[model samples]
Structures are given as structure tokens and as C-alpha cells.
Target: MTNPRFDVAGIGNAIVDVLTQTDDAFLEREGLAKGAMTLVDEAQAAAVYDKAGPAMECSGGSAANTIAVMARLGAKCAFMGKVKDDAFGRIFGHDIRSLGVHFDTAAAADGPATANCLVLVTPDAQRTMLTYLGASIHLKPADVDLGVIKDARVTYLEGYLWDPEDAKQAFRTAAAAARDAGREVALSL
Candidate 1:
């Protein structure tokens, strides 16, 4: 109803990615499929992390990255995603906020830690990923701020959000709000 407050509002998982370089033989030995994004549980995520070589951590997630890029290009944007109140979670929050995107989703007090994506890049430049959704999967309808969605010119939803029921509901809520407000909605496949 009021003047739009942001150019875009994005909703999806908040993930931290650890990327490392490995050879094709390493991928085969580890039974990792090349260039595939596989979902793994907490234990599996940990095992992959342990087996990975020295890595660099970065804030990553489909919609989250999109919002970050929008902010960097001088587009006002907001993001909604769930994380845990832990170290990696804090890092993710800090990184996004530092990019000047509005991200006000509260962190879980307990439960699993923030999500982690383990990415291994082979010599062929193929990336094999294993993701543990973790606390990011807890994003719910309540986390979607209708006001923000209404105030944004467009509400963007990420395909990965559908992987989690609560996040899927949140995505739908945001899309509905955008529609109700006569705003545009974009869904990334």
C-alpha cells in the first residue's frame, strides 16, 4: 500500500559453502558424483567436511546470493532465511548484512547448526556439492514478512526452498503477498 521500500525481496535457505579443489580421482574415490548437488544429512555433511582439503568459507544460497548481487548493483533488497545461533550462522548473517541487504529473520536458539554446502571442484572445473539443509530448512510462513513482500517491487523465490516444507510454505506466503500487493513475483527454477 505504501511506497515500495525495496527493489526486491528474496526468500530461501541460508547456507555457508566450503569450496576446495580436488582431482577427478578423488571424486571417484569418494563416490561423489561430478557436477551434482546432493543433499546429505548432518553426519554425512560432517564426514565430507572432514575429508575435504583446505577450504574457504563463503555465504551462499540461491536466492540469498541473488539478493546480495542486487544489493551490490545498488538495488535495495531484503532477504528472509533461517539460521541457527552459532558461529557459522553468525558468519552468514554478518556477510549478508555487510552487503547491505536487509535480513531480519531470527536465528534458531537450539536444534541443528546453520546449513553447510560442501563444494569440491575438480581439475575439469566440475563442481560436486553435498548440502546439509540444517537450520535453514526451518524457515516457516511466520518468517516471511508480508510487509516487506508488499513493499518490494518483486518477491523472488528459490527452487531449493521447495525442498523443505516450511520454506515452501514461506515461499508461497511471500508470493501471495506480492500478488495481493500488485507486485511482481519471480521464481528461480
Candidate 2:
């Protein structure tokens, strides 16, 4: 057994959120079901991005956000997820790292771009999400760093990762490592 190096290790989708403010009319015009998350392909993502007005891009995802918040609260955390060597990917990696969270997952050189979530917030404060999984879906068991998992006091997992077989394997690996180390594993549904 080794000394824990991190308070938590998170495994989940690495997504970049493109938030935009819109009205019900705009949501209806875009054929979006308000307040629901819909998965989109690359072409659909492009169409939505084109239709959306000015947007604010930020690093986001279920467990990813959890790790960022935990780190901000002064908890040592490590994040494991996949991204591409593209603009959004770079930004996502940089944002998490800048927050003092350890993220050493390798970026895919040749693949889809980083995942993008088009979050449309309406006047009622309700959000509608359109997501393109992109390279984040490429996360595999190999990306799960056993050392980081075992060295963390807890491992956090996101249920969204279940959509991808590889990512699901990575999540299981991390959880197993944490369990073997007698650490806690938390799942965010």
C-alpha cells in the first residue's frame, strides 16, 4: 500500500459546454425539447452550433464538474477522461488543470473533436442540452490510471460513461482499483 496522493479520482466524459441564452420561441424554432438532454451527432452538433447565438464555452461534464468543484474546495483530485488534440480538447484539459486538479489523460491525435454540449438556458432558468460525445467516448480501460485510482481516497464515476463500452470499462477499472485499495467509490447518476 502507498500513501494516497489525491483525495478523489474522477472518471467521466470530458465535455466542453457551449452555453447560450435563448427564448422559448428559439427553442421551438430549433425543434429542441426544452429541459431535456438529447444526444447529437457531429453534423447535428454543427447545425445546432450554427443556429445558436453567441455562446460561452466552458469545461463541463457530470463527474468532471464534480472533480473541479472538489478541487476548488481544496480537495486533491485527479481526473481521467478522453479528449482530442483539438481546440476544445486543449481548452478542456487546460481548464481542469488550471483548477489544480491532476488530469494526465492523453489526447487522441486522430479522432473526433472534443465533446460539446450545447446548453440553451431559457428565461425560466431551464436548460436544454444537445451533446456530441466526440472523442470523449473514446475513453478506454487503458486510460484509467491504476496508480491514481489506488492512491485516491475516493473514486467518482459518472453514469453517462455507460453509453460507451470503452468508457464503461475504464470506469469499472477505476472503481475496482479503488475498491482493492480499500477506498470509496461514488457514482453520480
Candidate 3:
């Protein structure tokens, strides 16, 4: 029986990556660390943005990024991740759907805003990320969909999602569900 779900499903953060090019002195002056994904709170997110110059907002999240590329390569895809039902979240959801990926994860209608990341790209092209999980932290085992697991050929995940304990639990549940469905589970650091 053909599963009526999808070929690829990913569960991770739903973030808008703000990328900007800077020099080494810029990082030191701003008290920012380099080349690591640092978890931040909303205030820190704001602080980073206030300091950063012009940036380009791109739809991103570790697993989400991989799924996006896979989709661009024409792989059938689906993504399950939490987001605030606010503007940024809506835009991320729309972008994925436009690429023909299935997304049915419920958005947190009354929590923190959608997640956002500050991506500082140096002249050397090395990237450092500071993230605020925001509403994406609400992801729990209950948020995972068993049907998506059944239909997808691969279930992909990102390690960064483990920042919040609930989300970590959700990842475990999703992986177990995918295993039960005989689907491949891919994990990326």
C-alpha cells in the first residue's frame, strides 16, 4: 500500500537565519564567539540583531536546511517542527509548502514568537549561529505525528533541537515511530 504521507519528513527548529558578513574584529568587539551554534534568549537575539548590520533573512533550521536542499534536488519532503503562528513562522511554513513539502505541525498560537537565528558569516566564509528557540521549544512527543512517520521514506533530525528537554523527548519519540514504520532515520550534527 502506498503511504499517503510523504517521502521525506524532518523535525527541527523553524528559524529565520539572519546572515551578514563581518570581520574578525567585529566578532571580538561584539563579544561574540565564532563558529559555534550558541543558544540564546529573546533579549540576546534582539541584542545581536541591534549590533548586526544589514542582513538577509533566510529560512533555516539544521534539518530544515537539509530538507530544503533535498527538495531543491527534487526529493519529496515533509517537515514537522514547532513555530509561533506569527509572521515569521507563517513565512517559513509557506516557503516549505511552496517547495511541495508537507507540513502539518501545529503552531503555538500563544507562546514566544517563532525562532530566529543570527548567522555571522566571516570573510573566510565561516558561519557562527546564535539562536533563540522561542515557540519552537514547545515541541514535545505529543507534537509528533505518527502518520508522517509511516509515509516518509526518511525521517531527518538535527542535534540542536536537543536544547530544550521537551524537544529532546519529541525527537526520541519521532525516531522511534519512524523505526517502527521501517523508515530510515538520518541524524546530523
Best by TM-score, which number?
2
lDDT, each prediction: 0.91, 0.91, 0.84
Clashing pairs in 1: none
Better of 1 and 2 by lDDT: 2
| Candidate 3, lDDT over the whole model | 0.84
Least accurate 10 contiguous residues by lDDT in model 2: 163-172
TM-score for each candidate, following the candidate numbering:
0.91, 0.93, 0.84
Please give me the total number of clashing residue pairs in predicted model 1: 0
Roughly what TM-score does model 3 have, to 2 decimal places? 0.84
Q: Which candidate number maximizes lDDT?
A: 2
lDDT of 2 by residue, 1-189 (tens): 677899999999999999999999988998999999999998999898898889999899988999999999999999988999998998899999999999999999997989999999999999999999999989999988898999999898988888777888888888888888999999887
Give the better candidate number (1 or 2) by TM-score: 2
Per-candidate RMSD vs. true structure?
1.7, 1.5, 2.4
Q: Where is the poorest 10-residue window by lDDT in model 3?
A: 1-10
Model 3 clashing residue pairs (backbone): none
**lDDT winner between candidates 1 and 3:** 1
What is the per-residue lDDT of model 1 for residues 1-189, given as tens digits with 9 covering 90 to 100? 677999999998899988999888888888888999999999999987898799988889999999999999999999998999998899899999999999999899999989999999988888999999899989999988898999999999988778777788888888888999999999999
RMSD of 3: 2.4
